[model samples]
Target: MSDPHKKIARKAELSKISSSFRRLSSRATLGAMVAGAAVLMFIAIGVGEHLATLALRENERLIGNDLAASVDKVLDGASTSSRANVKTLPGSPCIEVERKLAELETHLRYVRTVALVENGRVYCSSALGPIDVPLSAYVQARRRAKDITLLAETPFQPGVPVLAVFSSTTSNSGVLYIIEGEYLSDVLVHGVRYGAERAAFAISGNGVLDEKGRFHTAIDADAPYSTGVTSRAWPFTILVASSPSLMTRQRWAFAVASGAIGLLVAGLIAAMYLLAFAPRRLLLAAVRQGLKRKEFHVVYQPIVAVSDRSVVGVEALLRWHHAKWGPISPAIFMEEVESSDMLEEVTRFVLQTALAEMSALTPAFPLRIAVNIAPRDLQRKGFVAEVVAAVRSLPPNTTLVLELTERFLLSESALTSAAFSALRAEGVRFAIDDFGTQYNNLDLLGRFPFDYLKIDRKFVSQVDTVGADLIAGIVALARPFGVKVIAEGVETQSQHDGLESVGVPYAQGYLYQRPATAQSLATSISSSAASAQH
Candidate 1:
């Protein structure tokens, strides 16, 4: 007999462990989700900042292009006026050339002084009545210089920086015009209003004129992203110093929104894991693996007639020789499985194996092979078809009897009745197992068509004292329905004798035979055949 106390204690321990595991699993899941979400959020923010900086860098390049266009416009106007207007000065007298130079100076934009240079000599000026200065005094010497020049100071105004533009009319003669430095600085400095922090204009080799009207020989190279746009119309470049502060603001805003999205996705994944895949996964997976590994098999216990003890049939009982646990009692696991969906897999394993094993036998007499089934399997559509397939595999000498173990009621509806009728036509039979124990057996017998009633083991164990009168009454009640009675668990000779005294016809228990493997049964058959031959 199985140890009932150990089974109860094992079940209680498993329940307690399952509860603890569930709590631990839930907390671990939450922590993992939070860490995963945080990682995703940080990655998203980093990527968002990178993309935003690229866009901002492109924007700054466009702003520099726009500023370059403005500088082109101003230089284009200055170039046209310096050549066409200054050449029209009177050439007759010095005083007249000086008056014409002053008038041209007053009309030209950004011009400080206009002078005439002939054969590398500056002879006249606009600000002074007469002047004598070499052409090289204001700029580097060139025979036909048509370029810009930077002057830090003049003889008259001591320390005022100016630009000299020479537009040549001949190889050695050209008009010399001086331009104000402040106006050039103003055009370059306007970039501050757009995005740059510091703005300046750099001449080819002279100096850099900054936004503050000051000049330096070299510009700062360490400034972040110092952008330069060279003028196509002049011999200088516009430079602006930049920082990432412009894109920083927009990057942070986009990062916050992306972080929120990451959290929502993590929450959805965690919810799906808990709801759809976590609970009961371990037990179900183990059962599925157990089936694949062929850990389960069937055994048979012979049933004998009460009068002469002749072996008439056998009841097929499922036995599990687990690889890890080694011979688990069905009582410990069956209750849990009956309450779950794995009951069908277990039932089909026993049913198919028992039928095939019984069909392989060539016994001298007809044999009844009974297999137990749970009530829930009858409600399935494919169940009847599976049974029909297994039943057809048997030979004519063997009969298959299904004993219904009613953990739940097998409904007596039209659909179920049709299923039973279809199988009954194929010579399949039914027995109500453990009758008069968990439910009202008399009501059950009237509701469904049954061929046999198996008396529960509790009644058989106590037959001499309490169950003797009860078995007599149950056998009397079963007589009108044409139902036969089988008393189970007949352990002693006196119990068997008592069953006979009560007129029970068929029985199965340890007093007659214990459950044995298919190989054992075959060995017994071979020995009996050898004895008969002698």
Candidate 2:
């Protein structure tokens, strides 16, 4: 070819080839991006479904626990009635026994009738007044051994479901209390909160009571869960479950939103990952590491009796010192740790270390050692056993008080109630910390068994001001509930004097002594013992 003409043609051909290569590369890049987006969405859908299932299961479990607690609370009344000691004998005139029975029934809530049994026969009744029915007719032969007998119908009240609670003063003499089924059914109806349509309360093959209060002769195979919650105080179990279709709907709803996010989020995953996990992860990991390195310790602030100004108890407070970050205020890292699983470990560390420190002192006087616990710690596996073991480890003269801090409202579940009952039985006491500041203050006192109510420091700080009326009101409110009031944050003599004037029995704060180390607390204890001896 000629040199100039050939060069022009070759340049044009080169340009055409370059343009084709650019078009192919654009198509391939677009295909890769589309594939990545699809993969991201698929992962998002799977993760969303998994999370939804977990959330639903947790909700079901919580509701089930609550329902069990409610049933226990109801039955607890009848159980108390059965144990009543009345001077009116079973063979006494129907009117006198009926009057006594009616009086006793009024004292026991949810109780319909209080009948007296003599020689295995019902001689005096509260509802029918004189009755001559055999106790065997009401209590089944097999169920007679237990405290409760479930009756689908009674001879006097036909077609009514009732629980027969028996307490024996002697082998032949006892009290029989009737609790209507409708009251228990009310608890069941409100128990299913998270999209669960069917809920039932059953007592070990005796019968099932549905949300409608209809008593079934037998438990349905389908309604009861493989893991139903059983009440510790009573022989009842709760069933709670969301429908399969509802679960599928939940998964799909979560999946669709997650898939849409996945399409837009693929480009920003790195930033989002950091935002989701950085601060919590970094701080939580440090806390875990700090625990292992013994960077955490507890200090005790003396809780004193307001009248006598004596060191009655001390509350254990946790402190941490990070190697890299220096001293970290619990206010900063604890919030991060508390929401994470690592909170369990931090709580255990503080509880165990605090007890160990107190054991070393073993002062002559009986000192109440108080430790704060998170709400989650109460329901965790081995929690009650852990506390019982710690309680046993303490000296007989020393008392251990678990102060439940009100960072979150503590849910009253059967498991929690069981924990409280077991520990309280073991002589371990409980106190509701930060009392006035939380939501549902009255509900907490009424629901849980607390030995003392610790007034939130803010109220104590205002003892010299407007909060005195509130303080007096709190003390008065606690009086009916029988929970002794202890004020926290007594910073001045005037505040202390105001707290005393308002009927606050006990208090703790900087006014008496700031939080001290174990060594200091031990020395103070020895001094207090010496003073008491003198």
Candidate 3:
């Protein structure tokens, strides 16, 4: 009986060991399968993205080359016709030239209107209807140069789009043109259909939409593209867009298959390593702890006066010093904050900190604090009231400079205007930050009772060196309207002198002083003011 009991115990032990080995083998196999799936999915995504990018880039190159070649052909044809009209014509050549031009127009129906420019004046024109031409510096420049200037989709007439191509015929003589009126619609329809597989469009420098017939995606031609020419000219942008539905379906299918395989593989690998490595409970714990411990801090950059180099204002810049990530840039963190819907909290913290710092400063100093207001903040319910309350909390002498960027300000005209008025009522000075960088309505400046016009850094950077006429015109426009011009990015003494020479009373840049903490700013200002007095 004792021998039989011992035999049963031995059998049970062997069975237990066998079961454990089987479990281990199954986990290992599962892990391998998951890893293989993950690798395959990764490869597919990489290949798809590469293919899409290559196709789009190649299409853009091809289209640009074709358009340029076509333009050259058109110019050559026009030039030949002009010479022929001069050689053989009865009576007034102008009348005969007009008749020849009419015949040419009928042949090239796509060419909207042809204008014969001679002696810096448009002598003759033909179109579907009469169009009024606005006198502009660009037109004057073209006339003076006697060189062919192609302006794609310029709105010479209100509610009408036309392509203007100016070409020189001989020395100091030329023909100015307008083309693709009704044909523009046809071209857009055709182009968009052809390029439907990829996102693409073309634009001119004067806020003209030349995207064939699809006016929906047509941005202001004057608006900045991510790349290409910085100066005003019609630059054609071709975009190749992927089908969203197809992408979504592919992603979903891949994710499901890959995720299941990855989980199985990871589980098997984790189990095998469990004996050597403790479960990664600490990593998850650390992440949870980090989320709770996250905090934000503020830094200040001074916006000083160009003339006396006096510290007039400070822009409050936000910084996040994450424990794990160290320091995250405002651009990256702000994106996260916005996506998380915690922007109001961030904005409150920044405003409160800046106002508190400024309030602690000496009353006699009278420094303005410029706070960046995001577009989302402007649209928030009770946002205007919150701003009013925040301003009230600050010292009476502390002036709040609401710096509204062009992109943010003009998005919702009625909402922005109301917000602007509300803030202005609280003695908050409004400044259009990055002025002249976009196709902004100058009339909007007149409409909005803004106290200061902060000329964009781009314009300021060039004012002293190259763009004198433009700078002069901007200063002239601002002066009479009681709007004080504050030139930003005044890096050189020459820039400062040029701005001061033109009566631009205020400025700010690295030349004056870098941004500092409130404590450092006080010391800097005292020293600056003393130097000015001396």
Candidate 4:
């Protein structure tokens, strides 16, 4: 060494340079963190605004439904009264009928007038004055009512508010028409204004503005007609117009609050990054700790045969227990894993655990285990080989059923087809889960091999009067394919009977048994067997 003092000075200089570099790096990191925080804040604000708008739209839709139902009830009552006495009353009883009609008019004072049509003429009225106008004139004037045979609201005149309710009665002789005009301006001015605190408007089927009328700018240029609840019903639309300025004000307030919060978060992140790398290090440490713990588990749901009510299969469903979140549904956590590369690890773990469980059960029943395969996993390189290896390692008696859902099947059809074929070669079964959901390509069904098709729970459960014909059609289609049909969500005895009668061979639903642990399943089977023996 040239000199001991020189060596010390050199070391000191090196330490000082290192300290300066660290300070510069920390400042750069702080800037990046601040930028990232600003981006995240912007994203959150966008999502919040979108969700709020969606909520508002849904609220409007629900309110409209409620209003429609209430109006329908009123129309029903009026129609009942009109049909009950219109034909039976003689000319002498006209006075009595007029008195009754006057009382009915009082009952419906909110209504402008109620007109009854018989023999293609306006025969009776609610008003006490003599009916001087010709029936033909009234009929021609009320041609709009003829177009809307069902109960509906239409604007009678420009600016003047009116609601038209039309109903028809069919007897052995011919059809009789009843029409009632109700003033909706009072209802709109009082009811809707009080509730929503906004200007309200309604429109008729002919695109005529109601209440405020043709002069009002409530109706937008692009407003479309509502097909109503029934398809055969006339085209009618409801428009509720409010001040656009109020909406703008609310949006501006939300934006300002969001921006302020975003700026504050950015400042906090900047400060933290400038001070230390504590937050990043903490996150990495937490992730590493989680991987080491190996706390993920799975729950099983039994799939029973409908005809015999025997446990034929169990679907292995993933479950996660976060130290903070307790038990989390797979639908959520699986999505997070799927977005990352850790999904393969999760699949391997599930496969191993499920196989081990199957091996452990003494005198293993001839049961199939259905596992949902994510499309991403199928697309992974060497995925098929890995799955084959896993299957080969499993016990001979265990039958693995791969359930490909419509979402996964729709994308990468060719890849999924190849995967299915390869798995089938290894003695594994394949099923199209939630079948009859969407219009699937029949050509694909013919070309690709599928062992079973699980009918969607919605279609299966609705095998009553409304859906009876549809269910019959589906059953008929499946019959030729020779593929066993398994109906899901058979909740009631009536539903079970309906499916069984319609040739649904198998089913999985709560009516038979809910999902249970391995031990609980065994106990359930034992109880069921005991009951059978008795």
lDDT of each: 0.74, 0.78, 0.60, 0.57
| Overall local distance difference test of candidate 1 | 0.74
What TM-score would each prediction reach against the true structure? 0.46, 0.47, 0.43, 0.44
lDDT of 4 by residue, 350-410 (tens): 7767766765665455567777776677777788897788778765556787776754565
Q: Candidate 1 lDDT, tens digit per residue, 1-534? A: 479988999999999999999899988977887788788778877877776666666666666677778756655556575566666552335677788778877877777877887777777888875777887887775533367766666777766777777776666667777777687777766777776676776776776777676767677566434567777766767776654576566577767766666666666665445434555656566666878999888999977778777666779998877675466567756766777888889998999898878676666335678998877777776989998988787876567888987546665788778877888987888888888777555977788778889999899998877779999999999999888999999999889989999999888899877899865776544443332210
TM-score between candidate 4 and the true structure = 0.44
**Model 3: number of clashes?**
9
lDDT of 3 by residue, 436-525 (tens): 876775675777777778888888888788866677788789877777777877788788788777777777887776666777788776
- Write model 2 residue lDDT over 1-534, tens digit each, in one string: 899999999999999999999899877766776687778888998988888888777767788888888777777656653453552365566766688777777788888888888888988877778888898876655334347777888998899998787766567767777888888778877865556767787778677878888888787775655337877777777877776776788888888888878865874653344335456677677778888898998998988878877777889999887665455568777767767898788888888988888787745456788998877777889888888898888876678888887656567788888888888999988898898674656778888888899999877888798888999998988888888988988899999999999999888999889998877876666666433311
TM-score of 3: 0.43
**Candidate 4: segments with Cα more than 4 A from true spot:** 1-292, 410-415, 438-443, 525-534
Worst 10 residues of 4 by lDDT: 170-179
Name the lDDT value of residue 199 in candidate 3.
Answer: 30
Give candidate 1 misplaced runs (Cα > 4 Å). 1-279, 363-365, 523-534
Error of 4 at 383 (Å): 2.6
Off by over 4 Å in 3: 1-295, 335-340, 362-364, 411-414, 527-534
**lDDT for position 348 in model 1:** 89
Least accurate 10 contiguous residues by lDDT in model 2 = 269-278
RMSD of 4: 14.9
Native-referenced Cα lDDT, model 3: 0.60
